[model samples]
Target chain A: EPEVTQTPSHQVTQMGQEVILRCVPISNHLYFYWYRQILGQKVEFLVSFYNNEISEKSEIFDDQFSVERPDGSNFTLKIRSTKLEDSAMYFCASSPPTDTDTQYFGPGTRLTVL
Target chain B: AQKVTQAQTEISVVEKEDVTLDCVYETRDTTYYLFWYKQPPSGELVFLIRRNSFDEQNEISGRYSWNFQKSTSSFNFTITASQVVDSAVYFCALMDYGQNFVFGPGTRLSVLP
Candidate 1:
């Protein structure tokens, strides 16, 4: 079965440095999303992207965060400046054409900022 | 606001035992979707099942079954005769028509031999 895949399974970055997490969503899916889970915390939604635009975002997705679908298959999340609290697992998910379609998740990228 | 609750933080069962994971949700939208995902120690979140608000039917597949109760706003999952392979962290999630998705704190299951 086809699955969502992410690059840089684990990353370590210095505080105040920029970081980019990349994902290749399942081909043929139309909607994409980014979510984060702090260690020992619930998964929290960050932003959703469709049609090359942001569909929705959470308060946690503030000025530092941005998502891009630079190519057909590549979706990426960039943090302009990392903070210590940014250490967490970031997941990328994609859904089919329908709004109610089931969302498929990727393995996740563990981001560690020090 | 949409929220999902998985009250049980962790559960341990011997192999061949049956175990149930509870999920409750809060949503104001009349139409919504509920889902379950399993994450093994490997850290990949695998989709298990999805149930819509309109469907109250109980579904069974292999040793896994799901109970969807609109009245209680709950969607619970059960594994029968579970094996060690069933050990994983399971999460319940809710999404409204507006595309707001929320996930509960996962329940970690450990099936020992």
Candidate 2:
């Protein structure tokens, strides 16, 4: 089965540095989303992207965070400046443009900022 | 505000034992969706099931079953004859028509052999 895939399975960056996490959603899917989970915490929604634009974002998705579907398959999340709290497992998910509401997720990218 | 609550923070079961994970949700929207996902030690979120508010049907697939109760606003999952491979943190999530996805703190299930 086709699945969402993310690049740089693990990333380490210095605090205050910019980082980009990339994802290639399932082919033919329409809606895309980004979520994060701090160690030992519940997954928190960051933002949702559709039609190459942000559809919705959470309070945690402040000015430091931005998402782009620079190409047909590549969807990327950029953090303008990483904070220690930004260290977490970032996941990408996509749902097909259908009546069903299932959103398939990718193996997360573990971001570690020091 | 939409919220999902997984009351059981962790559960331990012997191999071949049946385990049930409890989930309760709070949502004001008349129309919404519920979902369950499993995160193994490797930390990948695997979609297990999805149910809409209108459908209160109980579903069974292999050793897995789901109970959706709109009256109590609960969606519970059960694993029958679970194996060691079933050990993982399972999360229950809710999403309203407005597309706000809220996840509950996951229940970590440890199936011992």
Candidate 3:
């Protein structure tokens, strides 16, 4: 079965540095999302992208975060400046065009900011 | 607002034991979707099941069964004769017509052999 795939399975960056997490969603999916889970914490929604634009974002998705669908399959999340608290597992998910389609998740990229 | 709650933080069981994980959700929209995902020690989100608001029928797939109760706003998952491979953190999520998903804290299950 086709699945969402993310690049750089693990990333390590210094605080104040920039980081970009990339994802290649399923080819036919129309909606994409980014989520983060702090170690031992619940998964938190960051932002959702549809039609190459942000559809909705949570409070945690502040000024430092931005998402882009630069190409047909590539969706990326960029953090301008990383913080120590940013160390977590970032997941990329995508869903079909259906209203009630289930979002398929990627293996996740573990971001470690020191 | 959409919210999902998984009350059990951790649950442990020996092999072959049946365990149930609880999920309660709060969503005003009559149309919504509920899902269950498994995260093993490998730290990957594995899709397990998904149920829409209109379909309340309980479903069973092999050793896994889901109970959807729209009246009580609950979707519970039960694992029958679970094995060591079933050990994982289970997450219950809720999503409405909106884009984002609201995930529960998750329940970690350690199935010992």
Which candidate wins on lDDT?
A: 2
DockQ score for candidate 3:
0.57
Q: Supply the global lDDT for candidate 2.
A: 0.93
> lDDT for every model?
0.92, 0.93, 0.92
| Candidate 2 segments whose C-alpha is farther than 4 A from its true place | A98-100
Computed on C-alphas against the true complex, the DockQ of each candidate is: 0.57, 0.70, 0.57
Mind giving the per-residue lDDT tens digits that candidate 1 earns over B1-113?
88899999999999999999999999999999888989888877777888888889998989999999888999999999999999999999988888788999999999999
Q: Model 2, A1-114: lDDT tens per residue?
A: 999999899999999999999999998999999999999999998999899899988889999999999989999999999999999999999999983367899999999999
Say which prediction, candidate 2 or candidate 3, comes out ahead on lDDT. 2
Clashing pairs in 1: none
Clashes of each: 0, 0, 0
Native-to-model Cα distance after best TM-score fit, residue A104 in candidate 1, in Å: 2.7
* All candidates in order of TM-score, best leading: 2, 1, 3
Pairs of residues clashing in candidate 3: none
lDDT of 3 by residue, B1-113 (tens): 88898999999999999999999999888888898989999998877888889999999999999999988999999999999999999999987876457999999999999
Displacement of the residue B99 alpha carbon in candidate 3, Å: 4.7
Chain A TM-score per model, please list them. 0.97, 0.98, 0.97
* Docking quality category of candidate 1 according to DockQ thresholds: medium
